[model samples]
Target: MTVTASIDIASSPEAVRAKFLDFASLPKYHKGFFASLTPLGPVEPENKIRVVFSSGQKMYAPIEHNTPTSFAWTGSIPLLFTGGTKFTQEEVFSGALSFLMGENAVARKFGFPEKTKKGWEGYNNDLKAWCEAK
Candidate 1:
């Protein structure tokens, strides 16, 4: 399942990229994001970073796509999550949340209905607030 959101931001792609690179600033606006972001090292597209959640869930992911206008990262599997985040600067700022539960896991683990969808919705709303804020 995937949940995505987009909004227009009156800023250049470079400006948006700058903001995206600043993961530590995420929680200040993205309510659903980590309570705090700790940069372990340089911010490269393939660099891995640890995300410690307020709820004490620690997840890690390497930057999957990083460009002058966009960036994306997929959560590290069994230890982290299934999907990650994406941003695009084509008139509107866009964000996406996707979960790829393997067939075995889906059938055995998270068989809970509506749980995943709700989580994604919350994530989308938070991203919207963060990106659309003036």
Candidate 2:
């Protein structure tokens, strides 16, 4: 299932898209999220970026359909399921939530776990607050 949520950022779409493109800078504002990105080597275009977490979970998505109003990513999540841990679970679910939302409004109505949905709500709220504050 997909859990999604959206916020109407007060900033223009260009600003929103710019924020999205500045993923590598997230570590400055978002604690614990180590955004490690690398070009997809010779196999893909430069726009194809692979983002890895400090937790070892990785997400690969192209900078698809980038515009002043929208930014989208199409990619698969990697998993190495073993036993279990809080960090692992959080990483997997957070990755899924980010993929589903893509920071869009319609995703607010997407269905998923109640906790996950609430988490996205909080995320969207945070985004709105940040965008509106500046």
Candidate 3:
């Protein structure tokens, strides 16, 4: 299962993409959702970057998609969880554990997909506002 959310931004795709791809600026503009973001090095497919969520969870994921208008990453552990904050210009979740985890105890308790949907929506709104304001 995957949860995703997207919105139309008045800004150009390049401008929106530019702001989203700049991971380091996340905390400054997307303050409510991000604590701090640090890119380990040159960002490109296969490179790993570190992200600290506002909830204080620090995760590391490999760059899965990086392009002119899209970006995504995957944080995985063998055959289990391939999850994280879903930092795509879109908010998303997937993988073997997307909806299955030891009888869905933790996932159901935390409502990962639902919660993520809300967070992703917030991100979309935040991104749109920032991009338009520029």
Candidate 4:
């Protein structure tokens, strides 16, 4: 299943890009949803990053940044009772920024599709507020 969320920020695309690249500061706005975001190493197309959820579940993914335009990552969570779920998340910045999320059938079966869409909408709202404030 695939879902997307988008918002227009009262800031330039360049400003939003700069803020987005500062991965370390993500938790400042996302703290309620994510426990923490840690970079495994330097930023690169395939750089691995660790994302810890508030529930203590950990996920890892290779991140790709397309300069002042977009970034994306694919990751998964192991579900002992039902195999696992694979997901691809992308963020694109134009005059606005959009969040796209895609998950496998297994994930959809477990209701991840709708949850992810709502989650992205909330996250993007916070992101828009942050960017506009700067």
Which prediction has the highest lDDT against the true structure? 3
Please give the CA lDDT of all the candidate structures.
0.48, 0.45, 0.62, 0.55
> Residue 48, candidate 4: how far off, in angstroms?
0.7
Tell me each candidate's TM-score.
Answer: 0.53, 0.50, 0.74, 0.66
Better of 1 and 3 by TM-score: 3
Give lDDT tens digits, candidate 4, residues 37-125: 67788756678778786768788868654443545555532111111211123333223212222344555566655665566666667
Candidate 2 CA-lDDT value: 0.45
**lDDT of model 4, residue 72:** 57
TM-score of 3: 0.74
State in Å the error of residue 125, model 4: 0.8
Question: Candidate 1 on 2-111: residue-level lDDT in tens?
Answer: 22334344445455555555676776666653555555677666676786655677867686655554455565311111122343221111245122332346533664
Cα displacement (angstroms), candidate 3, residue 9, comes to: 0.1
List the candidate numbers ranked by TM-score, top first: 3, 4, 1, 2
Query: lDDT tens digits, residues 33-116, model 3?
Result: 556667677787788778777788888878776665456677532111112222243333466765642237787787766666
Which pairs clash inside model 4?
none
**What root-mean-square deviation over C-alphas does model 3 reach?**
6.6
Please state the error at residue 79 of candidate 1 in Å. 19
The parts of candidate 3 lying over 4 Å away from their true place are: 76-97, 100-106
Backbone clashes in each candidate structure, one number apiece? 0, 0, 0, 0
Q: Look at candidate 3 and tell me the lDDT of residue 30.
A: 79
